[model samples]
Target: MKDRKSARTKETIVRAARKIFSEHAYHTASIRMIGKEAGIEHPLINYYFPSKAELFDAIIREICEEFAASAGEWFDAIREREITEGFTEFIELLMEFNRHNPEPLRILALNLTQTKDFSLIPGYHRFPDLISRLHTLYVEKIKPMGPDQEIRMFLHSFYFLIISFLGAGPCIAQVQGMDPDGEPYREWMKATLLFIFLPRLKDINLPRAAAREDG
Candidate 1:
């Protein structure tokens, strides 16, 4: 019972911290603000998290873990089988992840736009593995043209596509008289991303034989 209570308290603190961080960005967000948002005393927050930096680190870890798990599942699913036209479904899964986790996405946008110090964010330790896993998956699916750099560019483009749309938010969409969170816009983004990537996928060089493999 005590452990459960503690867990709940920590979860509440995290929820409040995510909202405050999204609204104020990391540097501007304060412990007092998070405490108030969580309906807990500021000291309670300090008891759970030693400092604002630690709290922010916790959030980053949580976000990274969630993304790693989701992406890992998709990676495992396509390990043996080719992605082929399953790219559409993959894109939709990414969109769905962002849709359900807008707060974390907003927090990430703040980190990207305001600080840009990715080192401060947690979960990057898994990045090398994530990239390696993705390389294997893409190598199987696209059978890329040249070297790892070509594959790296493709992966970077995929990252940018997801970030660009998620970072836009309602404010950016409103400028164009569109709703970023709406299903119509999501479908449009999905289609646009697919249109941009499908040709590249199709144009990629076929897989080299075991003797000529460059990966």
Candidate 2:
């Protein structure tokens, strides 16, 4: 069943490798396993990527580019709305993004979140660009709220909680005796996140011009 001559061998390999990496994480996944999952000869992988680390970087870049494009669209879509309306829409868009792109979330959990040093991946260099793209969208939350210690704490909470939700939401749902894939839990999570975050958005004044300028 190994068809090495496929015209899209590189793409095939990437798809297969993504599955393996997302399932196994970086340390446990091997190129040989990727090749087997790819139904490709091991040497053929070298033609596309110099090494496993480079391939991992390639995947990270792919995900970063994908997210950057999505975040831009999300930012534009929310620009005209009132603050609460925009924040609500943004959260739904993020949930939809996670639903559609669960693989990226899973891969992130596997490779990044479990470790104290998230820079464990060789592709850490691309993180600044990724953060820049996200930060652009993130400013919507920060702008009206202002970048205080509370806002910083909110960012940390958002990252840790959202990632945890995405990674283990089903198990948590099950523990609560809810259907993991049912609408109930999905709605519950959205409502829960809003409950946690919306209070911060309520009644917050934008920083004064003087304070903004000083910072």
Candidate 3:
């Protein structure tokens, strides 16, 4: 009973911390605010987490673990065939997750822009291995005529573009002269993704004249 109670308390604290950190970011969010949100005393946060950095690391680790577990299940289901479709489904899942939990996405953006200190997070260490495994899965699925590097670059660029588009929603809207409000924005985004992935999309011919001159 005592261990169960402790687990509940820890979960409550972590949930509260995630909410607060998502809004105020890692450096700006105080333990007092987190404890208040968690409905516990301020010092209780210290009792549970030794320091602010430790708490932040714990939150990131939890998120990464959850993502890994969820991805593993999805990957297992689609391991046999049609790898491109599986990859597309995975991207859609990530997009839906970001749309639902915009706060965590915001927190991630802040962390990337402000902090270079990813060494404290265990997830950072495992991320490369995870990427490599995912790439191998893709290679097995799509027996492309191009080199492995070419295929990897194509897939990586596609997902990276998706992430950047979602992550910089405000800036993209501003640059594109579109309103960042309501159903129209969502529709526009859906259309944009469709256009990018359409089989009939045309390629732009770069100025080979310049390359020839340089050569």
Candidate 4:
């Protein structure tokens, strides 16, 4: 009973923190605010989390673990497939994931871009491995133009773009006079990825390393 109570208390804190942090970026959010939102004393929050930074990190770690459990298989399958197929599947999965879990992504997108010290996110350490897999997919499977540097930049840009797009998708849709939840918009995004983005990627001039490998 004690453990169950503790678990509920912790979850309540996290849920309150998630809501507060999402509404106000990390730096702007205070433990007092979180405690008030959670209906607990500020000291109780400190008892559960040493600092605001630690609390923030806990939320990110929780989000990453949950995302991994849900989407890990899709990433694994991407490693097994051809680059085009993998990339298409990845984009589709991202759209679906965002559609279902908008809150976490919104929290992440806001905090990540606003913060300079990325060490706040405990899951950040795993990012290198993630990028490494993408590098292999590009170099070994697609063999896209340019060297690893170019591929790294491409991947970074895409990651930011996708996250930002999903985070601000509704606002963007409104601005563009489109419905974010509409099937037509989703289909347009699918076609844009395949016909436009993929085609443009194909146009990048091959670096000497790639050209030599081809030769």
Candidate 5:
């Protein structure tokens, strides 16, 4: 019973901290605020988390774990498909994931762009090396869109753009007078992204790097 109670208390602290972190970002959020939100005393919170940065790191790690679980199904959907189809699956799965768990992504975006420290962005260390893996995969799977730098630029730009979308999607939809949390918004995004990128894919003309090796 004591262990169960301790586990529950830890979860409560984490949930409260997640909410507070989401609202205030990392620097501005305090242990007192998290404690208050959790309805536990600040000292008690210290027992569970030694420092505010530690708590914040914990939350970021937790979010990564959350997405890691959801990402499996996404990979399953796109694993054997054509490049464009896989891309489509990527978009759809992310959209669906956001539908259910929007807060974590918003928190991530808030930190990624808002942190003043360019040297080490907050929560930057915890993320996996997905960018490098994706880059390698693109080299093997798709034709060269341009020189290596331009292709990398495309990937990097799309990354930040997608993170922005994941974070501020509701705000953007609302600005355009649509229901941000509704199906119409989802379809609108799907159509919009495809319309913008699919044609670019053709124009960019990426040749498969694997064929170069074969030849």
Candidate 6:
């Protein structure tokens, strides 16, 4: 009973921290604000977390767990369907999650920019292995003519695609002439993914002009 109670308290603190951090960004969010939001005294957060940085790490870990759960669900869905469709479904699921969970996504982006202290986050450690697994999955699905080279290039291209979308939010808004905080932002993200991945561009044979024009 004690352990369960502690677990619940920790969860409440983490959730409150997430909300505060998401709204204010990591640099601006204060432990006092998180405590107030959680309905706990500020000192209690120190008792539970020991330090503000530790609390931030805990919240990031929770976010990572959410990400892992979403990825597992996508993989489970893929296992039940054709393997070729897995990539499309996975991308769509991610876009949908980002569209809905903009807060967490915003927090993650801020953390990436401002912090190097992600040791407590589970998925942070497994990043390399995760990338390898994703690469293998793509290679297995696409089976491009030059399978090995194509997989490498595809991974690189996809990396750039994701980085551009998430990291260049302001630039993306400028290009589309839409407010970064508006609904069009999400639509642009979805359309960008579809434009890059859905057509199986690897299989298409066309001159640079035609490819560029169509793309």
Per-model TM against the reference: 0.80, 0.79, 0.67, 0.70, 0.76, 0.65
Tens-digit per-residue lDDT, 45-84, candidate 1: 9899999988888887777667767876765554443334
lDDT (tens digit, per residue) of candidate 3 on 1-215: 99999899989999998888767756678999999999999798788888887888788766656655555665565544343454456556666766776655455545555566766442355445545655665545433444567556665565456545665566676677776444566567766665665332111111222333466
- Could you give candidate 6's per-residue lDDT for residues 1-215 as a string of tens digits? 99999889988998888778867756678889999999999998888999887887667666656765676666666543433355567666776776677555666555555556655432344444545665565445433344466556666577546645754566678787987657788677767776776555433212322544576
Tens-digit lDDT track of model 2 for 1-215: 35565548889888988888778878888899999998889899988887999998888788778877887788788765665677788778877898877766677666665566757777756756676556656566346456556554665576567766775666688998998667888888888888888767543433433354476
TM-score, cand. 3: 0.67
lDDT of 2 at 16: 85
Residue 191 of candidate 3: its Cα lDDT?
65
* TM-score-best of 3 and 4: 4
Clashing pairs in model 3? none
- Which stretches of candidate 5 lie above 4 Å from their native place? 118-122, 127-151, 200-215
Kindly provide the TM-score of model 5 when superposed on the true structure, using C-alpha atoms.
0.76
110-198 in candidate 4: lDDT tens per residue? Answer: 76766567666544555555545555655664446655575677766776666667766676667768898887667766766676456
lDDT scores of the candidates, listed in order: 0.71, 0.73, 0.62, 0.70, 0.73, 0.64
Candidate 5, residue 55: the lDDT equals 82
lDDT of 2: 0.73
Give the runs in model 1 whose Cα sits over 4 Å from its true position: 77-84, 116-146, 205-215
With candidate 2 superimposed using the best TM-score fit, by how many Å does residue 70's alpha carbon deviate from the native?
A: 0.8
The number of residue pairs in model 3 that clash at the backbone is 0
Q: What is the lDDT of candidate 6?
A: 0.64
